[model samples]
Target: MSSTSSDIAITGANGFVGKNLRNFLHKKKINVLGISRKNFRKHASEVKITSTNLLEPKLQTKLKNYDALVHLIGTGRRSPKSMFEEINLNLTKNVIKACKNAGIKKIIFISGLGVSRSNKSDYFISKYKAEQEIINSGLDYTIFRASYIIGKTDYLTKTLSKQMKKGVIIIPG
Candidate 1:
């Protein structure tokens, strides 16, 4: 099926990066469909939200009509190692498989910078594993390994700003 009219499907559309993307795409007059856990009431006119658990069995059937997918689902902070595997590894695998099954031609996956298989952190390991899945999927893909994105209300920036306000900052060795 041709994906001429279908909108771009953005996962994690309620997130900081997703919000920025949504605004930019809206300004460009591009249609955006958001797959988010919560309702997007503010941008409801320009974006449509679909509440979905990424691991659900019905996900492929639900996402069959989309033109392309922008996968932004991931965890940044430390958590149980299994959480990383679930969200970063398994969830990504499911999405890629679903897109392939649905005949979706393109995927733009948001990944973290400085991730490697040799890294000690479980976070980086999970990201690397996820990227591997995408690479081996045999689908048209763009993997954006991004650094810290600057936004006015970004959590990282806010935390950094707060720390800088204090006298001396200690760097981890």
Candidate 2:
């Protein structure tokens, strides 16, 4: 792809981090295409936004022309094991496959920290597995693992703040 051609695709663009990233990328004059469940068209008039579930088979063809993909789709809330696997693991696999098929060169994945093979939590385990899958896919991939991101409406911060206010401290093992 030519340096002048600016085409970037971002998944989970409706989420907090994704929205912030999109804004940041836009400020740098990058042409961003967002894929999300909610419409971001009004907020980003110039940016092309598509609302679709990543699991759908149509996503492959839809993502064909993009030069790179920023995959941020994941389930953070506690849920069933299958739900985590489906969103974090299976979705990543599909995204990798789509990128490979579409000849996309680079992929930037937003992942969580503390994801390891030895981890007991399903969430972290699934993240580790997804990272492995991305590595094995042979695409140029970059993983950004964040721990307890601080945002205005961050769930972790809110929960911790509430607990602190209650004067009852409970630490996760």
Candidate 3:
């Protein structure tokens, strides 16, 4: 990092990883702006958080002049209202558009581990497509295929806790 901090914007800033990253960056004296679908709880005054629906066209305007965008918005589960394509693939497209429009030259995306063209799983397919979209966008990008990121309040911990309450846990051999 240079003596002057670069402005960095993080999407999904309310998530476990996002929150940790924001705090880490802040400690390093970097300027971090959080973009989330929900309002963030009260925190340090130096960090700014904004709420926005990524699917809408307003994201580009909101992203204006950021040096880089950390796109952490993604999902492995499916709901009746939202699917893998909608969140993983579509939202990535939206992010790319926003980044380009805002003149951001770099994107840091957290994709899923084992997401490849050969994987037939819907989650993998969607993630694969999202990675492709970023690669094709011609913007500088760093994508991490993270497997299980465990933390005190991480998704894996919550899911395992629920399974434990069920009295039976399923693990592949």
Candidate 4:
């Protein structure tokens, strides 16, 4: 924040997509400031969180000077405390609020593929809600509904491997 504006600010920059995107952006000489939920501390102007909850409203003061935000804070899998809507939608709400507070426009979000208003699946519904929040927030935004990404120990791939061992490939219709 002391220097000029950053090219982009990434939420969930510690995750798989965020890591790859940051690397690609860096190669293009784009300066990135990252926000993470995991324990992250500025690593050469990248790592930027420790017990970081993007939901906190007070931190909006420090979220300034970023040209755009890449919102990657979401989950496909779920637990009791980490339900899809609870984490995904809520975090997105937080991001929108922070963006509004910081006067930051243009957020880029990667949402789940095949998610729609009529989607019956809980995961898709969660993503749809998050998307709707961004749309209604009156901020410039882009939502990318991405299909399954494959890589070493990635989320989808890991889940597929685990379920395969259980002798069931639960493909959602």
lDDT tens readout by residue for model 3, 17-121: 989988888788777778888878634634555655653555566567478999999887654334888988898998898888788899999999998999988
The segments of candidate 2 whose C-alpha lies over 4 angstroms from its true place after superposition are 41-46, 55-62, 158-173
Question: Residue 19's C-alpha lDDT in candidate 3?
Answer: 90
For candidate 2, the C-alpha RMSD (Å) to the true structure equals 2.8
Report the Cα RMSD per candidate: 2.7, 2.8, 3.0, 3.6
Those runs of model 1 whose alpha carbons end farther than 4 Å from true positions after fitting are 1-6, 42-47, 55-62, 164-173
lDDT: worst 10-residue window of model 4: 42-51
CA lDDT scores, all candidates in order = 0.80, 0.80, 0.82, 0.79
The full ranking of all candidates by TM-score, starting with the best, is 3, 1, 2, 4
Looking at candidate 2, what is the lDDT of residue 117?
Answer: 89
Error of 1 at 146 (Å): 0.9
Model 4, span 1-173: residue lDDT tens: 43544578888888888888787777776777777767644446454654366646545655676778999988886554348878778888988988887888889999999999998878888899999999999999999999986788588888899999999999975
Model 1 error, position 130 (Å): 0.3
Highest lDDT model number: 3
User: Looking at candidate 2, what is the lDDT of residue 36?
Assistant: 82
Please write out the lDDT profile of model 1 over residues 59-166, one tens digit for every residue.
Answer: 556566677899988887769999999988898998897788877788899888988889888988999999999988998899999998888988888877888898
Q: Which candidate do you rate higher for TM-score, 3 or 4? A: 3
**TM-score for every candidate vs. truth?**
0.84, 0.82, 0.85, 0.80
- Name the lDDT value of residue 153 in candidate 2: 68
